[model samples]
Target: MKEIMKDLKELMMKIDKFNSQQLNMLVEHIFDISNEDDILHLIH
Candidate 1:
């Protein structure tokens, strides 16, 4: 659970670094690829 929270926090930080338009595009791309069964699969 702690590792999961850490990862989530890191992801939030990454998102926070983007401009609004880049953030929107990043989110759209994430949603598009996030259906690949597992988050770990995407990360690796």
Candidate 2:
């Protein structure tokens, strides 16, 4: 769980550095498959 959270955080930070459209797509894709905890942990 911790490893997953760490990876998710890293992915989100990378996504943050993207241009708007790319970031939107990345987030959309992430939400499409991710569980509630994964998304919540990333956001918080």
Candidate 3:
């Protein structure tokens, strides 16, 4: 789980460079697949 979080953080850092529209789409896709706990983790 820690390794996964680390990798996700790295990926998010890379994704931070994307423009707004791309980020929005990516976020929506992620949310669509993510569970409730994952969504809570993301928002916090």
Report the Cα lDDT for candidate 1: 0.76
Q: How far is candidate 2 from the true structure (C-alpha RMSD, Å)?
A: 13.6
Clash tally, candidates in order = 0, 0, 0
Tens-place lDDT digits, model 2, residues 1-44:
99999999999987777767787887897789658887777778
Model 1 C-alpha lDDT per residue in residues 1-44, reported as the tens digit of each score? 99999999999887777667796886677788756675456557
Q: Give residue 2's lDDT in candidate 3 (0 to 100).
A: 100
Q: What's model 2's TM-score?
A: 0.42
lDDT of 3 by residue, 10-43 (tens): 9888777666769788789777965888777777
| Top lDDT model | 2
Positional deviation of residue 27's Cα in model 3 after best superposition, in angstroms: 21
TM-score of each: 0.42, 0.42, 0.39
Locate the minimum summed-lDDT window of 10 residues in model 1: 34-43
Q: Candidates' lDDT values, in order?
A: 0.76, 0.83, 0.81
